[model samples]
Target: MTQATHRPASWSVVATVRASAPVCNLFARHYLARGARQVFLFHDDASVACNVALHGVRNTVCQGRWWRRGRPDALEDRQVHNATKAKAWCETDWLLHCDVDELIWSAQDVGEVLGLIPDDVGGIVINTAEAVYAAPPSQHTMFRTPFFKFFFDERGRPRAYRAISQQAYGDLWNASKYGLWGHILGKSFIRAKADVGRMPLHHKKQERINGFLMRQQAPQLVLRHYDTLSPEMWKEKHLRRIRSEVSVPMAGRFRERQQALIAEAEARDGNAGLDQLYLRMSTLPPGILAECLTEGFVRVIRPEAHLLAQDHS
Candidate 1:
């Protein structure tokens, strides 16, 4: 019998976080369990608790005060700086830049996925699937669900957008042009040792040192973004933007919609307005979820919670 031979590739992940300790710990643990060689976490805040939570996790590095001269004004600028720093120091074959709320959902080992790509490809563009609430969520709910809205790359076929338009899903369809509340460009895995252009927010359309385009979009591995899993999360995220605590880009329809939502949220007292907007746009009723699944507008990706638990055990 001929034994199956798997090509060897080492990959790492990096994220700049300003979240709770548990959230930081889970983000590191999940990728480690998913076969990441190393996980680099740059805490945007000087939180001792978040750093301490990751201290014991094997093959993970947590850093604070990563900025040398001074911190950048925009959150995305900070992320790009940290990611570039990680790429310089990472010894792995590839380094991925992602957010703390995002997780890579892969059916196979991440390294194996990269190993299949041609050597000439300098970067890989992973698409995203935004998480959606299958049923009404409670106050404490946080990404504890299996439903996701997977929008395909419209570079070729416009099938995904056509399907969403056919739904006439009101606020849901009109939430963003790509039918996602978050970025449709997703995250990226840049070749660690390869000389490439400056890392942008999305990290797609990367050019090589020779000024040649070398970005390859791989739709197989999906970046599962838990942008807003519950009403509390939704409210707090928008509030941060409203208060100027977080920096969102000035351009794009997404930003315009976000500004409108922030204004609406501030107009109403308490969490009522945010809660209403969340229900109308983010959450999915049971019947609607089923119908979406049946029509192939949404997909059920039940990532294993035990994957991270096993590492902790």
Candidate 2:
């Protein structure tokens, strides 16, 4: 058995989460174990169970405190509000804003990696390795998936992911700005108290924002994003998206594309049709998964080894 190496630094993480108690606890545990100074989880839905579950965790802050007058209507608005407030409250050298489903993966301690960044660097972009499954696993077991793909982009273009997605979906696929199903531009760790105009849905990118400088991409760290794990989860997710009135800003055709897919699936065979579409898009076939692994389109990662002291534990 191997133990995580700790290089201590003042760094904290913040997220606006709505998840089960166990899920919330795991998020706190993983980051705390990975050497974050503290983990602030602002409950979007204010689940009492989740707050209670985190009680025993040292350096974990669980709260349902609304940022200001009341909760915002849009989910993205709530996220940005929570992240901004957490930044003000955090007494750390750096603060990371990411989702609960996204875990920081690094061979060296996270703080040690951040320590090397120069004072002039305002933030650092952590590249993402989106999780890919061979088969749909239960949501509880999704994080343990051994396969992940790091989409290669040349000058902000996802040529590699586009090629692979085209092979999978054929005529069904369309050219997307991002490589992955999730946010193509990964999350970031900003210097605490850095002057920023506003927080975007993800992070401020040089291409998208002016005067927001980011350091060269960190080599040792990658965000392991479990975008969708099971067909049931996928179905529930898209159904909510379709029904919701508040949509993401500048989302391009992504929202429209999802709504269309769900509608088509329902017309075909209701839930079963939706499940089939999800399976096809979310998980790779055995042959393609194997080929992607061999051809360097994707790579295998065992984060459990670092998080739990055992692979797939």
Candidate 3:
């Protein structure tokens, strides 16, 4: 077995969690193992954050009735709050701004990935590959576990995944290559915090709020995002955001999709229809993962992860 090369102690990650507390810990653990020196997690559940071994900022940022109501603004509020705090807390040379479910994967230690940004650059936009999975091993298993990933973007056909129940592993496909929100890449890290006004939910810098634009998109560094991890998880998450801010004035494909999903699901078979939609979306498994390597849907983890070292499940 090969070990990862030594990494610089100049990187830290900042993440915010609403209900995915355990997964946040999983995120922290994986990043730390991957080379990030420190990880700060902000959440509403103090008890849940307490058990996780990282800089736990419990209830400090994620607290509010908005999350309970499912306000989209709540996500913005939590991210901005933690992004600022991370700027203050991060003594490292650079800080990673990403969500709990969006884990950035790199072939080399992340220090190498961050090095791609020239000294004049404030940040780098990392390409994202949505990690595809199958109907989770069970509800007991966490969302987007690496073991089940096989493809990215949209390959196969809708019928392929819908057919998983009958055929465990045949041809799971993805149809879309772009993100639901339109942009496929997102700014995941920033070395210059002084010019940053606030962390925007989707991208970095938030327009011209920052004086200079030193951010460039790096195709080599990729972020594995479980945005719509599963129908059950997606429903639970977005429903809260919808409920919290049905009138929050945000308009986009994400919001529109959530609205339609909530309405259609409720009117149809409760959440059953939504669950099936997700199950169909997540039809790829390890067998297809090998093929994805050839097609560029996913990349193999570089030194591989010590799966048994820290069990966040």
Candidate 4:
């Protein structure tokens, strides 16, 4: 058996979760195994301490009273806090800011992705695509109702949208401006360096343009977001966020949205529908869900493709 070789890269990963979730722990293990040198997990809730202890993973814990004057303002505070920690602790030349629910996959090995970064570039903008469900029943899995493409900026506000790609070579993000009503001012800037090259960060909606004050690149890599998986997990995460003293305005809005989604899912196929969505998802070919939601129709790289090739050979 060939041993997996770890390639040194300039980037590190940072994530923050208020209450502990099983999915978050799974993501941490996956990233750590994939060659991320450093991983930082931040939580303000003391209850999460017990959960973290069970995992036996060493992490930095930030304990304090968390409160938000309003919903929108509170969401931004969390972002700022995480960014502040990343700036303080991450020693890598580049930083990838992501949440536990978001998973970034590369067909090429990790080293291949790192090799693409140029020497002169400050940051890369990644394109994000929201995955949708095509009807049917499955067990344990939840499907995305085809609502809006991630690129459709007008459908949803930007703050709710998370970034899978963020570089932290020189100037780190200033967390104070996160979730502020105005434009993202002074938050997404990196120091210019001779080694930085033209790289793009892909979000579900827009591509960050290259050479401009803010550089964006649309790489072939994909970020699969499993935001609506498992009703129990979803409910637990949202309820915790909504109950938080800091999550006031946004929490209320989130609750409304959650209720609506639940109603819609139940009405569509009943409890059976939810069950089918989950079960079918466990068996569906890879990337099929994402393909259904893309604007221009693209071929999904299904797991069956590999199986078929082997069978033919």
Per-model TM against the reference: 0.85, 0.83, 0.70, 0.54
- Which residue runs does candidate 3 get wrong by more than 4 Å? 1-9, 44-51, 55-73, 137-183, 192-194, 205-213, 245-251, 284-303, 307-310
The local lDDT score (0 to 100) that residue 261 gets in candidate 2 is 74
Where is model 1 more than 4 Å wrong at Cα?
1-6, 47-49, 52-65, 136-141, 153-159, 162-168, 206-208, 211-213, 307-313
Q: lDDT by residue for model 4 over 176-226, one digit each (tens)?
A: 112111112111222123223321122112222244233534254445454
lDDT of 2 by residue, 36-155 (tens): 876888776643336623432332233334444665677788777777777787788888889888998888878888877755566778888888888887756777787887676434
CA lDDT, candidate 2, residue 180: 57
Model 1: clashing residue pairs?
none
Candidates' C-alpha lDDT: 0.69, 0.69, 0.55, 0.41
Better of 1 and 2 by TM-score: 1
Residue ranges of candidate 4 with Cα displaced over 4 Å = 1-8, 19-21, 50-58, 65-73, 131-213, 239-313
Per-residue C-alpha lDDT of model 3 across residues 1-313, encoded as one tens digit per residue: 1232334427777777654545665677677777887777777445444446465322344556535745344445657666776778777777777777777776666787666454545556665555555444332243336632322334432223232322332222222323122235464577645476665455664432344444566655667766665566677665765666323343455456555655666678876776665565555555655565454444444324443444564
Rank order by TM-score, top first? 1, 2, 3, 4
Count of backbone collisions in candidate 4 = 43
Better of 1 and 3 by lDDT: 1
Worst lDDT run of 10 residues, candidate 2, spans 55-64
The 10-residue segment of model 3 with minimum total lDDT is 172-181
For 1-313, candidate 1 gives per-residue lDDT tens digits of 1222347578888887776665666777788778787788877766433563443233223343445567677787878887887888788888889988898988877778887766766678787888787655643345566878766733434346556534635644555655567777778888888778555567655355454335676766889998775666667667777778878653367756765765776587446766667776677666767777776667788867743242331
Candidate 3 vs candidate 4, lDDT winner? 3
- Per-prediction count of colliding residue pairs? 0, 0, 11, 43
